[model samples]
Target: MPDFSPTELAVPGFVALVLIEMIWARRRNPRAYEPKDTLTSLAFGLGSTVSGLLFGGAFLALFLWAWQFRLFDVPWSWWAFALCFVLDDLAYYWVHRFGHRVRWFWASHVNHHSSQHYNLSTALRQTWTGFLTLGFAFKLPLVLIGFHPGMIAICAGFNLIYQFWIHTEAIGRMPRWFEAVMNTPSHHRVHHATNPRYLDRNYAGVFIVWDRMFGTFEAEVDNEKIRYGIVKQLGSFNLLWAVFHEWIGIVQDMWRAPWGSKLGYLLREPGWTHDGSRETSDMIRQRWQERQGEQTKSVSTENPIAGEAEPA
Candidate 1:
């Protein structure tokens, strides 16, 4: 079989699915799809594809070079594909988690989350600076572990394809067992949500089990409505700004920060600063929990009879 990117082959399907989603939203809820947001998302997707074309060869060369030094020569088989899929997903969890935690990676990744609207097109909003960010380093170990470079590429492609359908709000929830095991639309909604309780949770790619095992999983709560996008919404739909704004923010932050703190601006979490002026996802979640606790206490204080033993 010829070695090729599954993602490349799926482009036509991706576009068709986006159109189908637009039709579904128009019939169901007109507000779910915005023209400017959808167009900007498509633009970013195009840019990401172009960047991949221009730089993919270099990365592939590097992977092939590393494959020569692999510890074992594992031949391709049905079982090998299954093993590669699971291993690649585990690698993806770390890659995705770090993309949120470390500013350097987030500079590239933030574009993916820049969209305020959650729809099929939003899945197309990918990073233009992925080549510069070197996020592929997370998968390098697999190449070094004896998986063929082409096999790894195919596995990664399928992972991306599986993620595309999960971006829609059209699907409410999957079957109970599927929701518990696989990454469903509901699970991914939490990943894209800006809600304080949902931030930095559910980083799984294909399986929700990874997030559950690592304590990053948070289920979609019926009471808490999800608001898509980052905490600070990008008010404009400018294509250039959508792709490069976070990178600009990183440079500005580093320039203004003191020498001792400059490194932290890049290496630390996305919201870290020279001082405690900004909030990271952990801080956001903590404040939310505290507010919930205070509300509970106030309710009990106001209605003491509700907490008291029933009068016989």
Candidate 2:
């Protein structure tokens, strides 16, 4: 592993590319640019940028300590780096899968899913508390195996940069061979899709192969426009809300319900319906339509005199 500087390694190029996508998306569809959604993106973008540096800094500190203690001889060969890459990718698969499966981890990850648009800006909507919660711990095995800390950081950064380009609707499926082995824009779009069929699937970070191999892959279907955002939409631009809204909902459910259902609500699938309660998606839409109909009736009632006042 060559010397790695966390400060230098942390760049805003990803965010810049995402901004470009935002501009392109606006030009393509004006209605897609919701003010609240953009504000949430802005907050998440800033938080992600800051958090990336923090994660890098933490890893750098750990690397220094490991080197000082002479934990193991740093492997600097091509074969060694290659091995590290493979192992890191495997670790990342589990890390990402766990992030979706566990409630606490999902709290940080939910911000990424808060967007209703699939563009580069949505890619910048990342979790900030990941390192604080030891999300990086999954990479520890590489260090234990004598892969240089620098190599781990470099490979991780490379994987992240690779993922940035796929977060778009601008590109579709690649050739069958590429689509089979790689994470194309189509796969990532499905990952972002909120359709019942797509939810919590395609959690692979760098490669779509893991999802396919692990039976988590779901192909995008034609004629079914993907509805983005979580099943329970987060209606806020505040960073805190973007991060913790689901967590708050989880806690609220736990507070109001018995322990068994509380645990079940989180651990079960995302759209899990209790014996008596409907899924949040159905409930929200129903309530919205009810309120809309009531408002229409009230407006008609108030305007009745206008029609009767003809020549007055």
Candidate 3:
């Protein structure tokens, strides 16, 4: 039983880097480090760390138990570690996607997006209720495929470590080739953005390729300033509200919803409502796209390109 947790090793690095980013933010954009927001985000990090401590063991045991039925006896070789890393990332892509698409999962995940600031600290804004979401199941197939639970665990920690640096505004963009294959800061900013075009986009954990292959990739447009945080911003920095607001919303919605529609509140996408009062990410993006199209047509009518014919 190898007891190596890379994340545990990286805690000091995480803190040191955040402090570095704060100094950089002060010189670059002071607003990037709102004391309250950063504090809230750090608190989220602490709570999530505690929750992971309390819950991560059970999931590891479940993975080991599932390993007894592995179809192939995969060895602990360098190549095996590499393959497990790739496969686990693919699994993370789906877990992240569902964390947005399903309200139940979103209730746990929304807190990660609660911060309006995009800094290294934001990466620490993890879900305290992730165990409740049962999203760890997404990685079960890897165990069943013969990857050791420890191998997957180490790989996932590295996957998490890879994600931490990408959660910053300090580094604008990675080199072109690197950006093409890997998930860079520019690519991930789109993931954390609330801009309609960016909503629910770029769910990659380590590689941006999953998003490109799945047709969920959206490039960050330079002209459009991203509004970080959820569609309905948590205007208050109340730690409890930030952490558990969505879960509370779920309960309230389920209680008021008619019996038949009750489950919809739990299973449907976040922001979904029986009567369509609140807008889902899909609805908001559609409306934004239509408006952009209409604006393009209006501009074309007003400024016809030299010899282009006008509409009757």
Candidate 4:
């Protein structure tokens, strides 16, 4: 297996930061860290690590196999590292976008979004079944484009590490210049939010520029409340239920679906259905936008700014 394990080395730092954030949450907002929720999230992280241990060798083998066909022999250097980091992030952006857009992938990703509380622990709420989703295929291009699978693996580690600190309400916003280019707490919060307008947006892993460029960017509105978790909140903290609920859902839908449309259960957006019974993110956003428009129109029509009643 190609080896570079920045994530393994960062474990201590992660624990310390989680403790610091927990202290901060106690002082600032106790609601930010539910004991059960945090425990569930940590369990999710532990399970995800075990899953990676089991499947990582196979994934690495695939990447290394593809490396033989690389278009360029990108050498190990500072510039190569920089290029790999950026490209790996770009790959992450698409993988993340698909994780929401496609149902099969979302079954795994939804594990990360199951908790209602948002905090540093929330960042550790990873998916145990990510290997089953085949999301790592997104990085195949980087390997085939000449980045060493090991270097790409290192960059991916650093990318995950970078994302951890952003999953909090402890920071309102970053410096304007930093937020403009980097994925900050502000940007990632919108990604976690279940609000209609915020759904399926801000998919950047390291760089915020990808979402802005792809038109999936949505700024957090100070006046708008953000409710964390999936569209349908899983009320229980039962760890097994949290991990497998969506996977079970996908299987159930596919089994019951007609033969011709069964694949839609796997391929379509998370809420898509055969009988128009469910609402996709697009549908939810569209309804929200229309309601907002009507509200604006009604406000303007009913309370016209009376032309300052003929000046004195």
> Which candidate leads in TM-score?
3
Put down candidate 2 lDDT per residue, 62-157, tens digits, no spaces: 865665545577558888777777778878888888777766567677778888877766776878777644677788767766776788877786
Question: Which residue segments of model 4 deviate by more than 4 Å?
Answer: 1-3, 306-312
lDDT, model 2, position 114: 87
The TM-scores of all predictions, comma-separated, are: 0.96, 0.76, 0.97, 0.96
Q: Which of candidates 2 and 4 is the stronger one according to lDDT?
A: 4
Minimal lDDT window, size 10, model 4: 303-312
Candidate 2 residues lying further than 4 Å off, grouped into runs, are 1-12, 19-23, 52-56, 59-74, 259-312
| Top lDDT model | 3
Report the CA-based lDDT of candidate 4 relative to the real structure.
0.92
- What's the C-alpha lDDT at position 248 in model 2? 78
Let me know the TM-score candidate 1 reaches against the reference structure: 0.96
What are the per-residue Cα lDDT tens digits for candidate 4 across 1-312? 345598999999999999998899888998999899989999999999998999988998888899999999999999999989999999999999999999999999999899999898898889989988889888888888899989999999999999999999999999999999999999999999999999999999999999999999999999988999999999999999999999899889999988988999999999999988999999999999999999987877787873234667
Error of 1 at 18 (Å): 1.4
RMSD vs true structure, all candidates: 1.9, 11.8, 2.2, 2.5
lDDT of 3 by residue, 1-312 (tens): 787899999999999999999999889989888989889988999999999999989998999999999999999999999999999999999999999999999999999999988999999899899999999999999999999999999999999999999989999877888887899999999999999999999999889999999999988889999999899998998999888999999999999999989999999999899999999999999999999998988888888893377698
